[model samples]
Target: MQKPVIRPRRLRQSVAMRNQVRELNVHPNELVLPVFVREGISEAQEISSLPGIYQHTLDSIRGVVNEAAKAGVGGIMLFGVPAERDAVGSGATDPDGILNRALRVVAEEAGDAITVQADLCLDEFTDHGHCGVLDSRGRVDNDATLERYTEMAVVQAESGAQIIGMSGMMDGQIAAARDALDDAGHDDAVLLAYSAKYASAFYGPFREAVDSQLQGDRRTYQMDPANRREGILEARLDIEEGADIVMVKPAMSYLDVLADVSAESQVPVWAYQVSGEYAMIQAAALNGWIDRERAIAESIVSIRRAGADAVLTYFATEYAQALRAF
Candidate 1:
């Protein structure tokens, strides 16, 4: 019997040939870097779990953002590590809060060259790991959290954030934030809905970066990883509710969902390379198992190949610089 009609192996002969036949490629403009900036700190504090990642001080954040801008990254996704927490998560909506301060700085440095995106979730401000306030039964209150998101949207826009990243995994969050932004005359600012965020174990190191106060799981709010079709449903709901951009969290494990959503959605699709994914690569590199730079670029490129128009990753600056060197 004939083995094959065409020689597929020919494309694998050389680096140039492989690249020429590569169907998917990662671009510099598609990379969005996630940065952790603390409220009050003298120097950058490295997160042991996420190597090469740090919680920068306000002064340090300015320099970091400036450097990322020069690297030609698509944008900076900001997460503020507050020095304090409360039941209501007041720091999230406060104009003087760390997040707002960083947003202003990022916007100033970027100035339309890149989108300054702010994580609009309350988990970073809450005393509990839950993304929202607790009810009398100690469960996350979805409706109440929506109200908080509305208020937070206004604050973020006021703080000069070009985009609000709804990463709390809460329902109705996109609609509520959109209404609030429109009412506050920030209708132009984009709402990037974390539409298919899952309650995955891959978020372990992120807890350290933002100093999460989570005691239990986030199953009720975040999607269950067992469900794939449901991600498409959630993405649809978010688009109908006014999300300017829809995203799937932890890109590597859920690339199928991202691809499906990208095919159906009218707006742009994005994916997040969560902390766990970053830590795994860092650990392998530290132990001399893999080339860190190549792994970082390859991982991000895989996500882009999976149908993400943009990606939120910790390696945005490094990857962008690498892409430009080509």
Candidate 2:
């Protein structure tokens, strides 16, 4: 046989060799854990749709924060489940609102050990379950929503959130939030914009986690998955509006969008491996259809390979612990 000129498989000859040549590494500090704290729950409640995740009570939040900190995870993204919901999502801006209160508790527990981020959106607090206020025609009032977001941003900052995750996808939201933060003397706080969040079916498990009362889809505000160029455009607008970090939601299904946003963005790019993605892996693993740990590792690695500077995932703690062992 003729001698071959190149052998690409040489690098794959052994685990040691593969490890040495690995171009992408998923580290504990690059993983962010997403947590939910319910308003009136006296005890921790499991989110059945999202296995191994809980709707923690205020008292229980400390335990969750301690566990995440112990895992050496990069950050914690907190979501609140209010006991009551209403028009304009009044609870969102209230200093004692579930989300705000949870932020305070978590910040106290975490201190400066890990980044504490709040989901600065109205959907969880709104009885209508829409991300913002509605006009007389029942359509999302974009400008009105921006005003609410500005207020929510300040409250979250005052509550000790190091980062505010602007996930409503409202127009002018970034500028409004930045201005509000500066005016309120929270200029030190960072804004993480969900610049390319899509109205996705993948949000199903999340709805269950938050007990979302959404009557219809959010297609009017969120991006359409069919459009890739728009993702880059959204990220550009956020960057121009003083967003410290820009993110693409439902990361796995939108890796193409994530990659595009990452390539063109000047700031750090993050991706959220949302609830459905997490549920699917858990379900498959339970059925013995996939190696749970390997799948988890590969899923996050794919997101990293697609250019995410960090990943927000339900499996963050487990993945971080595994990386620690390695």
Candidate 3:
């Protein structure tokens, strides 16, 4: 073989050399833990579809919050699984509703140690399993849904959620939420818009985690996965409407969208390594098809390399602890 004087492999020759030249790194504070808190439960219940994850009771959720804070995870996104549901998702805005109460509990438990985020959507509270109210024709009413979202924003802020994740994919949601929060004197609350959320099949495991009531899909509202350009458009619109941060969901499969949003956005861009992404890696690892720890690290690093300022994942606490160990 001819001698290659300009070999690039020099940098990869050692772990310390590679670390020094690494383009991206996943830190404990860049991971957000998504948690489920279920009403009418006294103990934490493991989610079967999402192995090693749980639907926690209020008391049990506090422990998770403390653990996340201690692990130096950036935040915890709280999803509520209510025991009761209604046509209009009345529980979502109630002061004592399961989500709001969990927010308060998490806020108290985490204090200033971690950002307290709440899922501002009706899917978990609605008996019909849609993100919005159905009109006379049984179609989701966009205008009516915005009204519910505004109410949700105010209540979530009141419950001590520092960040309100607007994930319903409703049109004009960010603007409505921003106005509602400001009017309610919650001007300091941050709005993290699920700006480019797609109607994807990867959300199957999440339905089990939240005990979702959805009968059909949300294709009418959520963007199509095939349309990549729409992701950038949606994210820009959200930014113009006062989104403090914009997100590209199902991170692994949508890195192009995440990169597009990160490039065009002036604000922070985030990606969600959704439940399906987590479940697949776990399943493969458990079956001895992959190196579990390496896969987790690679997945997170890939998301960050693609330009996510932060990532929300089920692996947040564990990954953060692992990172700290190094």
Candidate 4:
């Protein structure tokens, strides 16, 4: 065999050489840990489907938020599991609701060491399990939802959430949230839009995590998994609507969408390594089918390589700790 003039293998000959030439590096500061805090719980409860993840009480959540800050994670995304549910998801907007209260606790625990973000969706608080209030005809009312979202933005800001994650996929939600924040004198609160969230099967584990009351799918709102270009369009629309950052959810399955959004967005782009993605890796590793730690690292690194400026993952604290140890 003739010697090849171009030897790509030479660059891969040593770990140090590959590390030095690596085009993309995942950093602890680029990770955002998503955590759940349930009302009425006395202690932290482990989520069965999502190993190593938990549903925490207000007090227990403080420990985890502080731990994430200690691990050097960029931020913590808070999801509240309320003890009560109503037609309008009143708990979502109540100043003393689980989400708002958890936001206050997390903000205090995080301090300036990390950013505190809160989920501004109604699914977890609404009895219907929809992301918005239902109209008389039994469909999500987008306009009404925007009003609730505006209310949520103000209370979340009041609760000390530095970033409001608009994950409901309602039309004009970002603009409404921005307006509400400004009108309420909370001009400093940032908006993170879940612009390209897909209605994928991969969200099953999340339903379990939140104790979802959803009886049907969210295809009426969330983007269809088949349309890649639509992802870019959604992101562009959010940017135009004043989103400080845009996100593509279920990162591993939608790298193409994430890359497209990254190329088109003028703002920072983020990706969510959702529950199903986490569970699959854990399941495989538990069965000895894959190297667990390496899989977790590779999954997140791939998302970063695909153009995610930051990633919201259940593995954020663990992965960030690993990065620091390395």
Best by lDDT: 3
How many clashes would you count in candidate 2? 0
Better of 2 and 3 by lDDT: 3
Q: What C-alpha RMSD separates each model from the true structure?
A: 1.5, 0.7, 0.8, 0.7
TM per candidate comes to 0.96, 0.99, 0.99, 0.99
Q: Write the per-residue lDDT of candidate 3 for residues 98-164, one digit (tens) a residue.
A: 9999999999888899999999889999999999999999999999999999999999999999999
For model 1, the superposed segments whose C-alpha errors exceed 4 Å read 1-5
Number of clashing pairs per prediction, in order: 2, 0, 0, 0
Q: Distance from true position, residue 239, model 3, in Å?
A: 0.3
lDDT of 1 by residue, 1-326 (tens): 87887988988999999989888888778888899999878899999899889999877887877778788888888999899999989999889999998888878877878888899888999988678989999999999999998999999999988888998888888888888889889999999999999999999999989999889789988999989999999999999999999999989999999999999999999999999999999899989999999899888888988899998888888888888888
lDDT of each: 0.90, 0.94, 0.95, 0.94
Runs in model 2 with CA error above 4 Å?
none
The regions of model 4 sitting more than 4 angstroms off are: none
Indicate the worst ten consecutive residues by lDDT in candidate 2: 60-69
Residue range with the least summed lDDT across 10 consecutive positions in model 4: 202-211
